[model samples]
Target chain A: MNKTVNQKAWFLVLPVFVVVAFSAIVPLMTVVNYSVQDTFGNNQFFWNGVGWFQELLDPSTELGGRFFDALWRNLAFSAVILAIEIPLGIVVALSMPRHGWTVAFSLVVMALPLLIPWNVVGTIWQVFARGDIGLLGWVVNHLGVAYNYVLDPASAWITIVVMDVWHWTSLVALLCYAGLKSIPDAYYQAARIDGASRLAVFTTIQLPKMRRVLLIAVLLRFMDSFMIYTEPFVLTGGGPGNATTYVSIDLVKLALGQFDLGKAAAMSIVYNLVILAVCWVFYTVMVNADAEKKEVEA
Target chain B: MARIVLDELAHSYKPGPKGPQDYALKRIDHVWRQGGAYALLGPSGCGKTTLLNIISGLVVPTEGRILFDDRDVTRLPTEARNIAQVFQFPVVYDTMTVRENLAFPLKNRRVEASVVRRRVEEIARLLGLSRVLDRRANNLTADMKQKISLGRGLVRPDVAAILFDEPLTVIDPHLKWQLRSTLKEIHRELDLTMIYVTHDQTEALTFADEVVVMYDGAVVQTGTPDALFERPEHTFVGHFIGSPGMNVLPCTVEGTTARVDGQTIPLAGAYPDLPQGRRIELGVRPEFTTLAAKGAGLPVRVKRIDDLGRVRIARVDLGGRPFAATVPEGVAVDGDEASVILDPTRVHIYADGHLVAALPAGATAA
Candidate 1:
C-alpha cells in the first residue's frame, strides 16, 4: 500500500475540539482561576499565591486539619464500600438464577435500589431509620439497643454505610453477573470431567475468567464511593460533629455554606489529583499485569 | 480400558415427545468394543454429539442404560464415569500453565505429586508441548491450545474412554492433518476406548477403525471404511461416504434384472420375495460405473467431463437423471454420445432405499 497523507481530516475533528473547549476546558480554567486568587465581594480579586493550598496541606492549621480529616474519611469510606461490595456482589451474582424467567425477575429486583434517586435513597433511609417515627428506629429502640443516627456518631456512620451499601451493591453484582454469564459451559463441563470440586471450579475457571470485569468493578466502586455527595449529604447532613463529612461534602460546605471559593477550589484540585493519582497507579498496575500475561502467551 | 455399551439409549431434548423427530437420539443399542477407535460420522443435528455425551456421562439419556464393561453407569456423573471429552472448541484453564493444565485432573483426583509430575512430563513430551510446559495454556494459538486440550485427556491414562467432538474445527487447515495424525498415534499408544464425532467423512474414515454413519438421529450403518464405501446399507450412507458418492437411480426390479427407463441391469444376486409397496432402486459407486460404446448400455447425454489428471469424471444424464462415471484418462468420451453400465459385482438392488441384494461370493461377470 502506498501512503497518502491528508491534512483535511483536521476539519472533521474541529467540532469535537470546540465542544471540549467549551464543556470541559473553560470550566476547568475557571477552577484554576479560583484556586490561585482570593476574592472579596463585588468581583474584586487578588492573587493569594498558593496560600490556600499551603493551609489545606498543613494539619496544624484549622483548615488543614479539617481537610485532612475529610480526606481520610473519604479514603476509609471507599475502602469499606469496596470490601463490602465486591464479595457481596460476587455472591449475589453467583446465587442469582442463571436462566429462565427467574433471571429477568431477579435482574429487575437487583436494579430497584439503583433506580431510586440518590437523595431519595437518603430520605428513605432517614425516615426508615428514625428513632421515633420510623419503623426501623422504633424496632431498634424497643429492642433496647438505644440506636440513634441523628445524635450518635457511631449510629450515623453505620446508617450512612448501610445506606451506601444498599444503594450501590447492585451495580457491582450486575457487573459480576455479566462476567459469570460470559464464561462458556465447556469450561464447567471440562471441570466436571476433570473431577474438580466446586471450589476448584470456581477458583480455576470462574474466578480467573471474571478478573477483567472485577477490575472495572473495583475502579468504578472506588471512584463513586470517593466522590459520594448527595446520599450522605441528605442522610447525615455531615452531622454528629463531622463524623461522616467526606472531602466532597466538606468542599461543598466550604464553597457554598461559608462562601470560601479560593479554599474550596484548592481542595477540589487536591481531591481530583489524589483520585487521579491513585486511580492511575491502580490502572497502570492492572494493565501491566495484563500485558505481561499476554507476553508470556505470545 | 472398558467396553462401553449403549443399551437402547434414546434422548429427547423436549419433554413429552410425540413423534420420532422429537428425539435427538432414538433408541440406539450399540457396543463399542474395549480399546477400539470408532468415529461417529453424521451431518450436524444428527445426534452424534448427543451419543458421545451419553457415553461420557455429560448427558444422561432420557431412555436406556449405559454400561462400562459390566457395570451400569447410566446415572453416573462425568467425573465418576472417568471419561475425558475434548469439545468442539478448545477449553483451557486461562490462569494455569500448560503443565498444570495437564496435571489438573490427576491433582483433582488426588494423584500423588510425584506421579502427577511424571505423567505430566510424559504427556507433554508426547504431545510436543515440553518446551511450552511453563507457558500459560490460554496464551497459545488455537492449534496449540487444542493440543493442550488433547494432552489433558491423554495425561489421565486410567480413563475408560475419551470422546472427541469435532475437536479439530478450530485448527488451521494445514495443521489439521498433523493434529489428526497425532490423535491417531495417541490412540494407538493408549488403551482407552475412543469415540470421535465428525461430520467430515474424510476425517472419520482416516481416524477410526470402524465408522458409524448416522442420519436423522438414527444409526444407519456401522462398518469398516471399505464396507461403508462398497456396500453402504442405507442410501444415506451410499450418498455420504464417498467422493461424488454412489449413484442411486429409481428402478423397476423384476426377478434378477432391474430396469431404469427401459435400460436393463442384471443383479449379481437375486433379491427374491421383496416386500410389497417397497420402492426398488439400484445403487452403484461412481468409480465402478463405466461409460461404454453408445447404444450398448443406458443411453446418457454427456454434459461435462472433468479431467482429474489420473482419471476423468464424466458427468452424464441417464434418462433425465444425473449420473457420474469415473473413467481412466485413456478412456475418452465423445460429446453427446455416452452410455453408462454399472459393474454387476458393484451394483446392489435396494428395496425402498434399503439394500436388498448383497454381492454374492463368486460372481465374476454381469
Candidate 2:
C-alpha cells in the first residue's frame, strides 16, 4: 500500500500568516525601533542606548513613579476582577435552567455587554455614573451617600471597577455556563444518586469539570483588566489623582500626551513584557496542570 | 435491598389525558423483588427510559405512586431515593482520576477512607479497571470510561438499587458482550437490585431474570425470557421481544379455529368471549412456524432467505402480508411454493389490544 502526501495544504495557512505578519509583526517591529532610539520633533532621532530603560527602572523620576504605581494597580485590579468574576459567574451559571427558552434568553443577555465596543462601554459608564443625570449616581446621591465619581478618587475607582465588572463578568459567566452545559446529564444523575448536597455537586462535579474553561476565563479577564485603557481613560480621564490610572492608561499618556517617545516606547515594551511574562506564567501553570492531568491518566 | 413497586403509574407530558393518545405512559402496576435483576425493554421512544427515570426519581409521574419496598416514595427526590443510575453514555468526572471518580459517591456519603479505598479497589478489580485506577477518565477509551461509570455506580454497596439506562450503548460491539457478562457477574456478587433499561431485546433477555417489555410508555408484560416468548399478553410484547419478532396476521376466529389468509389453523383451546365484529389478530413466533407439505399449511412464496449459519430466516409473503419464518438451514423449499405451519400450542390470539387466547389454556379473546 502506498500513502499519498499533499504539500498543497500549506496554501490554506498562507493567508493567515500574511495577515498576522502585516497587522501584528510589522507594528511590533516599529515598537521595537522606537524603544531603542530617542526621536525629537520633525522625526529627528538619536541613539539613546537603553537610557529610557534605566530611567524606567529608577523610582525617583516621574516615569518611574507613574509606571510602578500603574503596574501594581493593574496587577491588583486583575486579581480582584478574577476573584469576583469567577465565583459570581459560577453562581449565576448554576442558577440557570438546564434546558429551555430561558437558557437561550440568558445566553443572549449575557453576550450583550461583550458585544459592545470598549470605548462605548467607557462612555456608557461615564454617562451612567454622572451624579446629576446618571441613574446610578443620582440614586446614590438621593440615598445621601455624597457620591461624586469624577471628583472623588475612591468613587472613581469604585465606578470603574463596577463598570468593568458589569461589562466583563458576563464573559466569565458565559464561558462557565458553556462548561457547565457541556457536562453530561449523567453526572448530575450520579450525584443525585450519591445523595450529594447542592454544595457538594457544585464543588465536586461543577467546579472540577469547569476548571479548564475557568482558567481560560481567568487569564483572559486578567490580561484585559491589566491592559484596561479606554474605559478608565473615558470614565475619569485617569483623574481624581492616580487612583484609576492603570498601566495601559499611563502608557498612552506617556506616548501620546507628553510625546516622550523613547521613554513611552520603552515603557510600552516593558508593559508588554510584564503582561507577556505574567501570561506566560499563567499559560505554563495551565499547560502543566493539563500535562499532569494527562500523566495521571497515562 | 428493597422491593420496588409501581402502583397504577401513568404519565403524560401534557395536562389532562382525555384519551389513550394523550398519555405518554399508560397506567402500569408491577413489582420487582428485592435483589432481583430486571430489564425494561422496548424500542426507541417507548417509555422504557421514562419508566426507568421515574424509578430513579429523575422523572415524577403524572399520576400513581412509586414504592420502594413497602414505603411510598413517589414524591421523593432522586437523592432521597438511594438509587444509583448509570446513563447511556459514560459520565465520569473528566478532571478526576478513575479512583477519584469511583470514590466520589463514597466521599460524598462521608464513608471512611479505608472503606472507600477498599470498595473502589474491589469494583475496579471487578470491572478490570484496577490497572487504570489513577488515570483521568477523559483520557480513557469509550469502553474504559463506561466501565468507570459502571464502577462508580457499583462502588456504593449501600445503594438500595442500581439503575442502568443503556450503559453499554457507547461500548464497542465486541466489548458489549464482555461488559454484559461482567455486569451479570457483578450483580451476582453484589446481589444488588438492578433495573437495566435497554431497547435491545438480546441484552434484556440475557441480562435480566424478568424482562418487562414496555411499549408506548406502558409495560405490556413482565415475565421470564421463556414465558414472555411463549405467552405474550400484548401483541407489541411478541413483536418487540423476539429476534425476527412474532408474525401477527389479521384473522377471524370461529370456535377453536382461526381462518387467516383463507386457511384454517386449529386453536389448541377455547378463546375468551370477544365482541362480535371486533378486529382480531393471530400471533405466532417465527421460531415455532415450520415448513410443511402443501395443502396442510398457509401457502407462502419465499421472497428472501437469510442463512444465519445455524438457522435460516425465510422472508415470505403470507396472504400478501410480509411474514418471517425461521427454518432449519437444510430445509428444501422452492422460491414459488413454500408453506408454513404454525405450532397450534404456541399460537396466540388478541382481541381489543390484549391477548385473548394462548393455546392449551382456557384462552379468552378479551
Candidate 3:
C-alpha cells in the first residue's frame, strides 16, 4: 500500500511561520547569539564560548553568588505568595454571593483588581505604603509598629508580597468561581439528602470539582510569581540591600544597568529554559490528567 | 418503615398567592402506606417533584402538616427527616470509591462502623456493585454511577422512606430495564415505603403497586395499574396513561345516550342531572374499541392502520374527530369507510374533565 505525502500542507503553514519568526524566533535567535559571544563597546563582539555560563554557575564567583541569592529569593517569594493566595482565593470564591443583584455586583468588584496594569498596581502600592503619606503605612506607624517599606527589608518583602496577592488573587478566585458555578444543583441536593455536613460537602464535592481549575491556578500563579519583575521593581527598586532582588530584577540590573551582555544573555537563556521546563511539567501533568478523566467518563 | 401522610398540603412559590393558579402544588391529602411501592406518574411541570421534595422535607409546604407514623415532621430539614432521595442525574462523590460512596450517608449519621460496613456490603451486593466496590465512583459508566447513587440511598437501614426522582433518565436504554427491575427487587426485599417519580408510563406502571397519576398540580387518580388502565378518573389521566391513551370525544349527554357530532352513543348507565352547563365527554380505551364492517357499528373513515407488531391499531375519523381503535387480525380494510365497535360497558362519561358517576338503579341525583 502506498500513501501520498501532502507536501502542500507546509505551504498552508508558511504565513503563521512568518509571523512567529518576526515576533518571537528572530528575537530569541538574537538572545542565543549573544549568549555565546562577548561584546565590548562600539558593537565589537568576540567569541566567549561557555565562559559566561561557567561563571554564572560557579557560586564562589561574585556573579554566581548574586545569581544564587536572587534565584533563592525568587523561589521563596513565589512559595510565600502561592501559600497565601491559593487558600485566600478559595475562601473568597466560596464566600461570593450565590444569586440575585449581589452576585453581579460582587463579580464586578472581584474583577476590578485584575483589570489594572501590573506597573500601575506596583505604583499604587508604592504610594500607598509610604509611612508619612499613605493610609496603610501611616495607620501602621501611628499604631506604633514603625512601618517603613523604603528602609526595612522585612517591610519591603511584605509590601511586595501583599501587592502581588492583591493584584493576582482575583484571577484564582474567578477561575474557582467559574468551576463552582458549573456544578449541577443536583449534587448539592443529593448531599443534603445524604445528610452530609457543610464541611463534608466542601471536602468531597466542591474541592474535588475545583481540582482542575486549582491546578491551572497554581501553575499560572507559580509562573507569574517566578518571573515577577514589574511590581516589585516599581515598588522597592530591588530594595535596601538587594534583599528583594529576585532573578528577573537582578537580570534587568545586569543586562541594562551594568551592560554585561554576555552574562545577561546567558542568564536569560537559562531563565527561559527553567520556565519552559516547569511549564512542560505542568502541561504534561494536565494532559495526562485530562486523558485519565476522559477515559473515566468514556 | 413508617406510614407517611400529607394533610392538606399545598405550596406556592410566591409569598402571597391569591388563587389556585398561583400554587405549584395544590392541596393534597394522601397517606403513603408503610412498605408499599408507589409511583408518582405525570408529565413535566405536573408538580410531581414538588410533591416529592415536600415529602423529603427539602421544601416546606406553604400550608398544612406532614406526619410520619403519627408524628408531625412538617418543618423538619432533610437530614432530620430520615428519608433518602435519588435524583434524576447520578450523584456520587467522584473522589471516593463505590464502597465509600455507599457508606457516606451511614457514616454521616454516625452509624457504628461494623453496621456501616455490613450495610454497605449488603447494599453493594444488592446493586450488583460488589465487583466495583473498590473502584473510584467517577471511573464508571453512567449506569454504574446511578447504581452507586441507589446504593447510597439504600445503605441507610433506618431511613423512613426512599424517593426516586426519575433516577433512570441517564441510564442506557438496555440498562434502564435492568436497573428498574433491580429497584423493584430492592423494594421487595427491603419492604420500605418507596415512591418512584417518572414521566414515562411504562416505568411507573411496571414498578409501582399503586400508581398516583397527577395532572395540573393535583392527584387525579391513585389506583393499581389495572385500575388506571380500566378506568381513568379524569380526562387528562385518560389522555396521559396507556400506550395510545384513552379516546376522549366531546359529546352532549341526555338520559343514557351521548350525542357526538350528531350521532348518538348509548351509555351503559344513566348520568341524570350531570349539573348545569358543563362540557360533557365520553372516554374509552383503544383496547375495548375495535374495527368491524363499514356499517356494523359507529361509521368511521379509516385514516391509517398502524401495525404495532403483536397487534394492529386503526387510526380512524369518527364524525370528523380523530380516534384510535384496535384492528383485528385478517380484517382487510379495502377503503376509507369502516366502523368502530366500542364496548358499551367500558365506556365512561366525563363532565368538565372529571368522571361522572353513574346513578344507582332506582336512585335520583341529590
Candidate 4:
C-alpha cells in the first residue's frame, strides 16, 4: 500500500497548538522560569539553578519539612475520601428511584450540593459545624459530646472530609446511576429466574456493568481531592496548628503569604508532576488488565 | 417434567381494566402436556410475551391460577416457580467464563459442586460450546452468548419448564437455522417441556410440535402445524399461517352454496344459519385454490404473477376485490383474464372473523 504524506495537515493542527500554548504551556513555562531563579523586588532575578528543588527534596530543612508534611496530609485526605465516597456513591445510586416523578426530584436534590460554589460549601459547613450557635455543633454539644472544629485537630479533619464527601459524592452517584439505567430489564429477569440472590445480582450484574463509570469516578475523585483547596481553606483555613493544611493550602501559604517565589514554583511543578504520574499509573494498570484479559481469551 | 396448566389466566397493565380491550392479555385457558414442545406464535403486540411471563411467574395473572402438575402457583415469585426463561437478548454475566455462565443457576440454588460441574459439562457439550467453556462469555459471538443463556436454563435438573421469548431475534440469519436445530435436538434429548415464542412462522412451525397462534391478545388457534395449515379454526389463523395467507372474501351463504359478487361457489357442507345481520365470508388458502384459463372456473383478472422460485402465485382481481391463487406450472397465462378453481372441502365459512364449524356431514342445519 502506498501512503500519502501531506504537509498541509500540520497547518490544521497549528491553531490548537497556539491556543494550548497561550492557555497552558506559556504559563507553565513562566512557572518553570521562576522555579530556577531567585527574585528580589524591582523585578531583579538571580539564577538559583537546582537549589530550591534540592532544598524542597530534603525534609530536614524547614521548607522541605513543611512540604513533606503537607504532601502526606494531602495523600491521606485523598485516600480517606475515596475509601468513603466510592462505595457510598454506589450504594446511594443503587437505592435511587428507578422510575416515577420521584426520580427527577431525587436527582435534583443529589445535584444541588454539586452545583453550590466550592467556597460557599466551605462557608456553609463552617457555620453549620460551629460549637456556638450552629445546628450541628449545638446538637452535638447537647448530646454530651464536645465537638469543636476550631479547637480539635481531629474534628477539623472530620469536618473537611465530610464536607468534601457531601459536595462531590453526587458526581459519582449520578455517573453510577447512569450506568445502572443502561442495563436492560432482561438481565434482572434472567437473574431472578436463575435464583440469584440480591447480593449475587449486584456483584455479577450491577458491578460489572458499572465498571467503566466507576473507573471514571475514582480517577476524578482522586485528582480533585488531591488538589482540594477552597473548601478546606474556607472551612478550617488549615488552622489548629496546621493539622489539616494540605499541600495546595500550604503551597498558597508559601507563594502568596510568605512570598517564597522560587520554593513555591518548584513545589507547584512537583505537585503537577505527582498528579500526572498518579493518573498515568492508574491508566496504565487498567489498560494492562484489560489487555491481559483479551490475551487470555485469544 | 410437569404438565403446565393456565386456568382462565388474564392480565391488564392498567389498575382497573374497564373492558376486554383494556387488557394486554385476554382470558386464556391452556393445558400443556408434560414433555410437549409448544410454540406461542403471534405478530408484535399480540401478548405472546405477556403470556410467557405469566407462565414463568415474571408476571402475575390478574385473574385465575397457573398449575404445575396440579400445584397452584398463581402468585409465586419467579425464583420459586423453578422455570427458566431465555429473553429476547442474550443475558450472560459478562465477566464469567462460558462454564461459569452455564453453572450459575445450579450454583445459585446451592447445588453440590460435583453436580454443578457435571451438569455444566453436559449442557456445554449439548450446545457445541465445550471448546469455549473456559473462554469469557463477553468475548464470544452473540449466538454463542445466546447458547450460554440456554445452557444456564438447561443446567438445572429440577426446572419445571423452559420458556424462550423471541430468543433468536438477535441471531444472524445463517446461524438461526443452526441454533434452531440445536434447540430441537435438546428438546428431543431432554424431553423437557419447552415453550418457544416467536413471530416467525417458520420458526414456530418447525420448532414446535403444537403451535398456539395468537392474534390481538387472544389465541385464535392451537393445533399441530399440519392441522393449522389444513383447517384453520379462525379467519385470522387461515390468514396468518400460510405464505400468501388465506383469501377471505365477503359472501352470502345459501345452504351449501356461497354467493360472492353474484357468482356462486360450491361449499362442502351446509351453513343455513351462520348468524343474523353479521358479516359472513369465505376463507380459502391460495395453495388449495388454483389459477386456470378464463373458461375453467370463476373468472378473475390476473394482475400479476409472482414466481416464488418453486411455485408461481397469481395476484388477481375477483369482481373488483384483490385475491391470490396458485398458478400451476405449464398453465401459461396469455392475457389478464383467468379463473380460480377452489377445492370444495378446503372452503370454510367465517362469521365475524370466527370459523362457523360446518354442520356435521349430511346433517340438516338447524
Candidate 5:
C-alpha cells in the first residue's frame, strides 16, 4: 500500500487566517505606531525610539514605578486563582450525583453563574459587599468583626478574590463535571472490585482522568485572572491603595486616566507581551506534559 | 471458596409488590455450590442481570436472605461482600497503566508490594496482557481493555465469587470463543465460584456445567445441558434453549394421544387433568423433526430454505403457523407437499403454561 498526501486542505484554513490577520494584526500595528511616537494636540508626531520601554523597565523612573508592581501582583493573583479554583471545582464536581434528575438539576444550577456577564458579576458583588446594607457585611458586623472592604487593603484583596471565586469557579466546575460525566461507570465498578477506597478512587482514577480538562481550566482561569479588570475595578477600584491593582487596571489608569499616550501605549505593549509570554508558558507546559504522558505509554 | 445461598429472594422496585405480577424477581430459593460454574440464561428484561447484581451486592434484594457459607450477607455493601464483577462494557482505568489497573485490587487490600507484582504478572500472563502491562489502558483496543477489566476481577484470589454480567457482549464474535475457553481454563486452575449471566444460548450451553433458564423474572428450569434439552420443565425453556428454538404447534389432547393439525402424535404418559376446551400447545425441537416423503408425514409447505453449511434449516408453513425444521443436507422434499414428522417420544405437551409429560428416557429420532 502507498500513502497519499493531499495539499488542497490548506484552502479550508485560508478564511480563518485572513480573519485573524485583520482582527489581530491591524490592532497590533496601531498599538505599535502609538508606542514609539510622541503626539501633541493635533496628530503631530516625533519618534522616541525604545525610550518608553526602557523607562517602563527601569526601577528608578517614575513612569516605571507602579508597572513592575502590578505585573508581580497579576502573576501572584493568577497563581492563587488557579490553586484555589481547580481544587474547589474538582471537589464540587466529585460530590455531584452520578445519575438521575438530581444530576441534571445540579448541572443546570451550576451552569447558571457561568452564563452571567462578567461586568454584571462585578456590580452584583459591589452592592452585595457594602458595609451597612449589604447582607454579608451586615452579618459579619453583627458578629462583632469590624468589616470594611473599601477601607482596608486586606479586605479589598479578600473581597476581590471572593468575587472572582464566585464568578469563575462555576466555569471550572462545569468543565470538570463534563469530564467526569464522560467517564463510564465501569471504571468506578472496577475500582470498587479492586477494593479501592474512596480516596484512592479519587486520586488514582478521578484525578488522572480529569487531567486534560484540568489543564484547560487552569489555562482559561490564568489568562482571565491575569487580564482581570471590571470585577476588581468595580468591587475595590484596585484600592484601598494598590493592593488589588492588577495589570489591566493599572494599564487603564495609565492610558485613560493620565492621557500620556506614549508611555501608556508602551505600557500596554509590555502588558500584552507579559500576558502572551505567560499564556505561552502555560500552553507549552500543558502540551509537554501531554506529550510526555503519551511517550511513556508508547 | 464459599457456597452461596439465596432464600426467599424477591425484589420489587416500588414500595411493595401487590401480587406476583408486580415483582421483578419472584421469591427464589437456590444454592450455588463452592467452586462450581453456573450460568443464568435468559432474554433481555428477564432479571438474570438483576439477580447477578444482587449476588454481587450491587443491588440489595427487597425481600431475601443471602448466605455465604451460612453467614448472612444480604445487607452488606459490595466491597464487604468480597465479590468481583465484570460489567457489560469494559471499565478499565484509562489513565492507569495495565499493570496498575491489575494491581489496584491487591493494593487496596494492603497486599505486599512484592506479592502484588507477582500476582499481577501471573494474571497478565494468563490473559495474554503481559506485553502491554506498562501501557496506559486507554490506548489499548476495546477487546484488550475488556481483557484488562476481566483481569482486574480475577486478580483478587480471596474474593468469594466472581460474577459476570453479559461480559462478552462487547467482544468480537471470533475472540468471544477464545475468551470463553480461557475462562473455562481459568475456572479449573483457580477453582473459583463463578456465576456467568448471558442472553446467548450457545455461550451459556458451552461455558457452564449447570444452566439456569429464566423467564419473566423466575427460573423456569435449572439442569445440565442434556437434562434441559431432554426434559424441559417449562415451554419457555424448551423454546429458548435450542437453536431455531422449538416449534410449538397448537393441539388438543384426547386421553393418551394428541391431534396436531389433523395428525395424531402419541403422548408419553397420562395428561394432567385440565378443564375441557382449555388451550394446549405441543413443543418439539426442530432437530428432532424429520422430513419424510409426501403422504408419509404431516404435510407442510416449504416457505424458504437456509442452507447453513453442514445442515439445512427449512422454514415451513404448518396450518398457517410458521415453523422451522432442521434436516440434514441432501434430503429432497416436494416444494408443494412436503411432509415433516415429529418424533413421538420427543414431543412435549404444555397446559396452562406448564409441562405435563415426562418424555421416555433415551428417546431419539432414528
Candidate 6:
C-alpha cells in the first residue's frame, strides 16, 4: 500500500479547537489576567504582578494563613476518607451476591446515593442531622452522646465524614465488584484442589486480581474528597468558625464573597495547579505500578 | 492410589428430572481400578466431565454413592477427597512464578518448607519447566501454562487419583502428541489411576490403556484400544472410533447367515437366539472389507476414491446409501461395479444398536 498525505484533514479538527477555546482556554486566560492585575470598580484595572502569589505562600498574612489552613484541612479529609472507604468497599464487594437478581438489586441500591446531586446530598444530610428535627440526631441524643452537628466543631466534622462515606463508598464497591467478577471459576476450582484456605485464596488470588481497580478507586476518592465544596458548604456553611471549610469553600469566600479578585485568582491558579500536580503524581505512580505488575506477570 | 467406584451414579441439572432426556448422566455403575489408565471418550454433552467431577468429589451424584477403595465418600467435599483435576483451560496464578504455583498445593496443606521446595523443583524438571521456574506464569505459552496445571496436580504425594478434563484442548497441534506421551510417562512412573476425558478418538486411544466410549449419557463399551477398534460393542462406538467409521448396513439375521440389502453375509459363529422388534445391523470396519467379483457379494456403485498416503479408501453407493471400503496399495478399484466382502471374523451383529456377538472368520455361514 502506498501512503497518501492530505493537508485537507486539518479542517476536521476545527470543532475541537472551538470547544476548547470556549470551555477552557478563554476562561483560563481570564483567570491569568485577573491574577496579575488589580481591578476596582467598573472596568478599571492596575498591575499587581506576583504580589498576590508571594502573600498567599507566606502563611503569615491573613490571606496566606487561610489558604494554607484550608489546604491542610483538605489533605487531612482526603486521607481520612481513603482510609475508611477502601477497605469497607472491598468488604462490601466481597460479600455482595455473585449472581442472579440480587446482584442487580444490590447494585441499584448501592448507586442510589451517587444518583443524588451533590448539593442535594448536602441539604439532605443537613436537615437529617438536625438535633431538634432529625431522626439520627434524636437517636444519638437519646443514647446520651449529647450530639449536635450544628453547634460543635467535633460534631460537624463527624457529620461531614459520615455524609461523605455514605455518598461515595458505593463507587469504590462497584469497581471492586467488577474486578472480582472478571476472575474465572477455574481459578477458584484450582485453589480448592490446592487446599487453599479461604484467607489464602482472598489474599493471593482476589487481592492481586483487584489491584488495578483498587488504584482507580483510591485516585477518584482522593481527588474528589480533596476538592469537596458544595456538600460541606450546604451542610455546614463553613460552620462553627472555619472547621469544615475545605480549600474550594475558602476560595469561593475569597473570590465571590470578598471580591478580592487579584488574590482569589492567584489562589485559584495555585489550587488548580495543586490538584493537577497531585493527580499527575498519582497517575505516574499508577502507570509505574502497572509496569511493575506486568513484570511480575512476566 | 485407590480404586474409585461409582455405584448407580446419575445426575440431572434439574431437580426431579421427569424424563430420560432431562438427565445429564443416566444411571451408571462403573469402576476405575487402582493405577489403571483409562480414557472416557465421547463427544460434547456426553457426561464424561460430570463423571470425572464426581470421582474427584467436585460433583455429588443425585442417585448414587462413590467409593474409594471400598470406603463410601459420596458426600465428601472436594477438599476432603484428596483427588486432583486439571481442567480444559490452563489455569495458573498469574502473579506467582511457575515454581511458586507448583509449590502452592503443598504449601496450602502445610507441607514442610524444604519438602515443598524439593517437590516443586522435581516436578518442574519433569515438565521441562525448570528453566522458567522463576518466571511469572502469565508470560508463558498456553502449553507451558497447562504443564504448570499438570505439575500442581502431581505435586501431592497422597493424591488418590488425578483426572484430566481434555487438558490438552488448548495446546498447539504438534505439542498435543508430545503432551500425550508425557501424560503416559507420568502414569507409568507414578502408577496413579488417571482418567483422561476427551471427545477425540485419537487422543483417547493413544493416551490410555483402556478407552470407555460413551454416547447419549451412557457408557457404550469399555475395552482396550485395539479391542475397541476390532469390536465396538455399540454401533455408536463403531461409528465414533474409526476415521471414516465402520460401515453399518441394515440386516436380518437367522442362525449364522445374515441378509443385508438382499445380499447374503456369511457369519463365523452361530447366534442361536436374538430378540425381536428392534433394528438389526451388521458392522464391519473398512480395513476388514475387500473388493470382490461382481456376483460374489452386494454390488455397489463406486462414487469416489481418496488416496490417503498409505491406503486408498473407496467410497461406494449401496442402494443409494454411502459405504466405504479400505483398499491397500496396488489394488485397483477401476470398475464401476464393486462388490464389498466383509471378513467373517471381523464381523459383528447388532440388535437395537447393541452388540449381539462377534463371529470369527472360519465359522460356517449355515
Largest lDDT belongs to which candidate? 4
Per-residue lDDT tens digits for candidate 6, residues B173-233, read 9999888888888898889999999999999998889999888888899999999999889
Stretches of candidate 3 off by over 4 Å are A1-13, A294-298, B361-366
Order the numbered candidates by DockQ, best leading.
3, 1, 4, 6, 2, 5
lDDT of 3 by residue, B1-366 (tens): 799999999999889999999999999999999999999999999999999999998899999999999999999898888799989999989989998999999999898999998989988889899899998899898989988887888888778799999999988899899989999898889889999999999999999999999998999999999989988999998999987989999998877778888888877778886877888889999999999988888999999999889889999999888899999877888789999888978999999999988865335433
What residue runs in model 4 are displaced by over 4 Å at the alpha carbon?
A: A1-14, A289-298, B360-366
Write the residue-wise lDDT of candidate 4 on B1-366 in tens digits. Answer: 899999998999898899999999999999998899999999999999999999999899888899999999999999998799999999999889999999899888899999899989988899999999998898888899899999999999988799999999999999999999999999999989999999999999999999999999999999999999988998889888889999999999988889999999988998867889988999999999999998899999999999899898999999999899999878988889889999999999999988898875477554
Candidate 6 chain B lDDT trough over 10 residues, lowest sum: B357-366
Colliding residue pairs in candidate 4 = none
Of the pair 3 and 5, which is ahead by TM-score?
A: 3
Query: Runs in model 5 with CA error above 4 Å?
Result: A1-22, A289-298, B128-139, B275-278, B328-330, B358-366
Give me candidate 2's TM-score against the actual structure: 0.90
DockQ of 2: 0.51
Give the alpha carbon lDDT tens digit for every residue of A96-214 in model 1: 99889999999999999989999999999999999889998899999999899989999998898888899999999999999999988888888899889999998998898788889
Task: Score chain B of each candidate by TM-score.
Answer: 0.96, 0.93, 0.97, 0.98, 0.93, 0.96
Candidate 6 or 3, higher DockQ: 3
Interface Cα RMSD, each model: 1.2, 2.4, 1.2, 2.0, 2.5, 1.9
- Model 1, runs deviating above 4 Å: A1-17, B358-366
List model 1 lDDT by residue over B1-366, tens digit each: 799888989999999888888999998999999889999999999999889988888888999999999999999888988688998899999889999999999999999999999999999988899999998888899989998888888888688788999999999999999999988888888867889999999999999999999998999999999999989899999999887888999988766678899988887776655677888788898999888768768889889988777668888898899899976546666668878877888887778778885535344234
Model 6 residue A36 CA deviation (Å) reads 1.3
| DockQ of all models, two decimals each | 0.72, 0.51, 0.78, 0.64, 0.48, 0.57
TM-score of chain A of each: 0.94, 0.91, 0.95, 0.93, 0.90, 0.94
lDDT (C-alpha) at residue A136 in model 5? 85
Error of 6 at A252 (Å): 1.8
Q: What is the lDDT of residue B60 in candidate 3?
A: 92
lDDT of 2 by residue, A162-203 (tens): 889899989888888889988888778777877778887887
